[model samples]
Target chain A: MNIHEYQAKELFEKYGVATPKGVAVKASAEYSTALGQINTANGIMVKSQIHAGGRGKGTFTNGFKGGVKFSPNKEKAIENATAMLGNTLVTAQTGPEGRKVQTIYFTEAANLGKRPDGRDDEYYLAILLDRATSRPVIVASTEGGVEIEQVAHSTPEKIFKVQVDPAVGLQPFQARQIAFALGLSGDLFKQCVTLVTRLYQLYWDKDCAMVEVNPLLVTKEGQLLALDAKVSFDDNALFRHPDIVALRDLNEEDAKEIEASKYGLSYIALDGNIACLVNGAGLAMSTMDIIQHFGGSPANFLDVGGGATKDQVSAAFKIILGDKNVKGILVNIFGGIMDCNVIATGIVEAVKETGLKLPLVVRLEGNNVQAGKATLAASGLTIVSGDTMADAAQKIVKLVNQK
Target chain B: MSILVKENTRVLVQGITGDFGARHARLSIEYGSQIVAGVTPGKGGQVFEHNGVKVPIFNTVAEAAKQTGATVSAIFVPPPFAADAILECVDADLDLAIAITEGIPVRDMVRAKRAMQGRRTRLIGPNCPGIVTPGRGEKSHGGCRIGIAPGYIHKRGKVGVVSRSGTLTYEAVWQLTCKGHGQSTCVGIGGDPVNGTSHLDVIKLFNEDPETEAIIMIGEIGGNAEVEAARWIKEHCKKPVAGFIAGATAPAGRRMGHAGAVIGGAEDTAAAKIKIFKECGISVAATPSDMADALLRIWKG
Candidate 1:
């Protein structure tokens, strides 16, 4: 559901919010044309569009190297872009594998003056789900272009929060209040308020999990602009908003996660050896915890969800077995609405179809549990059945160690 | 008398014509829930057979409630339509409504909660296994069967069982039954946020019930509802209570179980809740079997 910075900026721009004029280039030809389009003598900022933060560190582009430098020549921005395309860019923000460079955005760099009060003129504003309040809260701080979590921890008082009512939506007055709290006034402040309001509308309308505009910059000329933007939509709400779903860039995501989503299975790949397939979310986590507790690491956290049918379980099995790192499989179900026997049959069938060699441990409880165990027992695959969670974890750990 | 539902309670089914609705409707009737009427948006004036009872179907909850004098409503509407279904039952002045649908949007739940504010109607879950009372009757409005919990385990005893987990609740009930203990009432409050009731809310009712002796609480990771209830149990509630929280060492920031059953932050965890519950002098069960043993010890002592 997370979108790159350029995509978020495009959404902001569409809603009449002022953002730095930027061109997203994927090819050398497009990059050369972008250089002509910007025409700013002050030089342009070539930002590597990655989902992670802290792009300024040596992890990406050798720390930007003061202005922008091309490999062949500065004028051949297209050649430099071509060289950068499809390359993995490391950053303090990205993981060990490094985020792949999919699109490079060329934007006119901003030169904003310090505030009249001798502080940074910009501020960070993010709308995230506030579980405590059970609402989407707007988090704003005078500190711009930094992790909001750090600001929340270090200077909690400086962070201004407003819980938005989903029914009434974010009011213009609430946006104005936030703008004023960030020390804005007059037409520029009003413009900032208007932009924030629009962003809130976009957040709700698009069913976004988060809409963050870090460093809402106030230029030396007193113009307000969103210097950086990031938006993440709720994947569950994607069904209602097909347009946003279309904007998804699958190449930028974890391949395993993408594949799991295709099967309607929620899978988050982890660094472990045992691949877990559980019925409920709670049971899935419990299985993972018990696995870890028993000196075994879970390769992935996969929940087929509560109403999972045979095909979904079969597809989930394929996704789990597909991972080469998975040495063992643990299938746990506390079937309520879903039948355990159906899941057992699906797992057995999926193992046969996939020619799975991993050790399998299953504990099916609740509806049709006996039938489920009977089905697994009949399968030629070496399936281990445990009565309790502790027993299941113990058996799985033993099986994994035996391997 | 049982806590929320009994044999005399008239039941109205929302989304009754749907596949799940029809399936559970038949099972509930066989299990002894009063087969009053069913509500499906255009399926009024129709009757479905359950045992020997012929239950009439209506298009709306209001009309069904009026005709059958139904006191409890069991909703089987899809997730998107679940909130409205609960609201309709609330509007009809039904005493209790149990929603079986899962995956309702949190925003929709917020609205539903606001609508239910100041109303007498008690909502159970938009994503829960419905409540059950053993032989003297049961309400399985959700797609679950009440008969799954053996009638022998429930001896009309003073023990009250409340759980956020549906399947696990039945496991605990079955365990208690094996130990010659029957429940006064077993309520599955559900794990979803914006559910009909909380552990604290149900515990308060159980505390007031004369037939209820001890209580068994089953909670999961995600919300602070357990912490809130534990705080309440520490100060109020004179009876002994045993607690079990699922998912002790779930990874932080990863949602494991129910969409609402996620550990929202590091603190709102099963382990953290267990520690707090222990501090509150509540018997903590590490496993389902252990939960039953803890309850028995409390009851004996």
Candidate 2:
């Protein structure tokens, strides 16, 4: 549900929020044409478009200096774009493996306003659901252009939050309160109020999970602008927003995760040897934890949901085996609404279909579980049957470690 | 002396005509719950006949409640209309509305929950397994089964179980049943971030209930509901409590199947919550498989 900075800016613009004019290009051939579309007079900021944050401090695999760069001229902008596109970027957010840069964004750089003490006039602002209150909250801070968590941990007093009543939406007074809290006044203060109002509207109208604008900059010319945008939409609400769903980038997602979705399975890839396929979300998570607790790492977290057919279970097995690191598999089913026999039959069929070589340990409980265990037992397969979740995890960890 | 629904608590089904709703409805009826009526918007005056029992159908929850004296409703309406279904229960002034449907938009729940403020109805879940008060019959049959949980796994006893995950709750219940321990009531508060109820809310009810002598609380990585409940238990709860938190190995920011299962802040991790449980004098289960035993270690029978 996470979108790139360029897409977030486009969304911000659609809702009347002010942001620097920017152009995004996927190919090098479009770089000059894209640059021609934006205001690059003072300087053009070349930003690598990836889902994760810390792009400004990120380094490319090809030894490129920065994922985001400021070039004074058009030629320098093109050169920086050339070095960025198609290169993998490694940041604090992206793991050591990093993500490949598929798109480059060029935006007009702003003249940062300086305070009386010569500090940058920037602030952090984000709109998200405050789980504590079950309502939308606007988080504003004077400190910006850095991790908000660090600011929160270090100086919690600097953070300000305003909870909006869902029935009434965001109020004008609430917006003004944020603007004043950030020490804005006069025309800049008016601009901040307008921007906060528009951002809240966009957040509510678009069903966004979070809309964060780090470094809400005050230009020297007295304009408030969102310098960096990070927006994520709620997955549950995606059904109502087709336009937002189109913004999803499959390239940024793992292949197994995307494939698992097709079968109504929730799959998250991890780095380990034993893959777990469980019935429920909490059980699946605990299945992974128990695996690690038993001295074996889990390769993935896969939940087949409360009800699964033979085909879905087979698809789940296929997806688990897709990960090369998987040396063993654990199937833990606490069938409440789901029948264990169906899952067991699917496992037998999937093992035969994929010619599975890795060891699989299954612990089926509740709702015709005896039939399920019998089905697995009669399949003439080498599936290890555990008495409980802990037993299954230990068996798989032992089996995978034996290799 | 169950917390929410007992054996005779009259219940109704909101999407009784749909496949998922009808299936669980049949299961609930087979388990001997007093399923009095069905709500299908336009399928009024029809009878949902299953296993010799006939449930009268109504066009709205108000009419259903009025016709059958049903105080509780298990909502199986789809995500798009689930919020409306919850509001209908609130408007009808039902005692409890358990939304068994999953994947409801958080925006919808936020608005629904706000509208439900000071209302008569108590909401259980938008994506939950529902509540169960085990009957004294064979395999816990004749019990009041509200949502999609297997009734047979439960046994009417002095223990109370509360969890955020459906099957994980079942795991603990089964473990307790296997250990010859029975439960007074088991409640799944749902795994959504903005659910109708919280761990603290249910724990308070269990603490006051005379039948529930011990409690097992299962939570995962997400909101501070578990922590809040644990803190409250430390001060107010008068029973031996066992707790277990899942997602110890889960990565940050990843929605682990449940929409609310994502790790958000420092205090929302499993390790952090487990530490709080230990400090709060609750028995902490090292793994999911040990939930029942963890309680047995502290409270005997």
TM-score of each: 0.88, 0.99
- Model number with the top TM-score: 2
Per-residue alpha-carbon lDDT of candidate 1 for residues A1-403, written as tens digits (9 for 90 to 100): 7788888888898899888787888865677677777754655667777777666452444333212232323355554455456677776546567777788888777767587688768799888676555577898888887777778778988899888876677887889889888878888788878887888888777877788888889887778889888898765567787788888888777887888878778887777899898765545665777787789988877888766788998888888877888889888777755678988898889888888877888988766889999999999788899887778888988999897
Model 2 CA deviation exceeding 4 Å by range: none
lDDT (Cα, tens digit) per residue for candidate 1, span B7-99: 567888887788888887776776666768889887788888767789998888999989889988888888778889989988998999888
Using lDDT as the measure, which candidate wins?
2
Question: In model 2, which residue pairs have backbone atoms overlapping below 3 Å?
Answer: none
lDDT (Cα, tens digit) per residue for candidate 2, span A145-168: 889999999999999999999999
Docking class of 2: high
lDDT of 1 at A24: 88
Q: List the pairs of residues colliding in candidate 1.
A: A59-A90, A281-B256, A281-B257, A282-B257, B123-B196, B155-B182, B158-B213, B222-B262
Give each prediction's root-mean-square deviation over alpha carbons. 3.9, 0.8
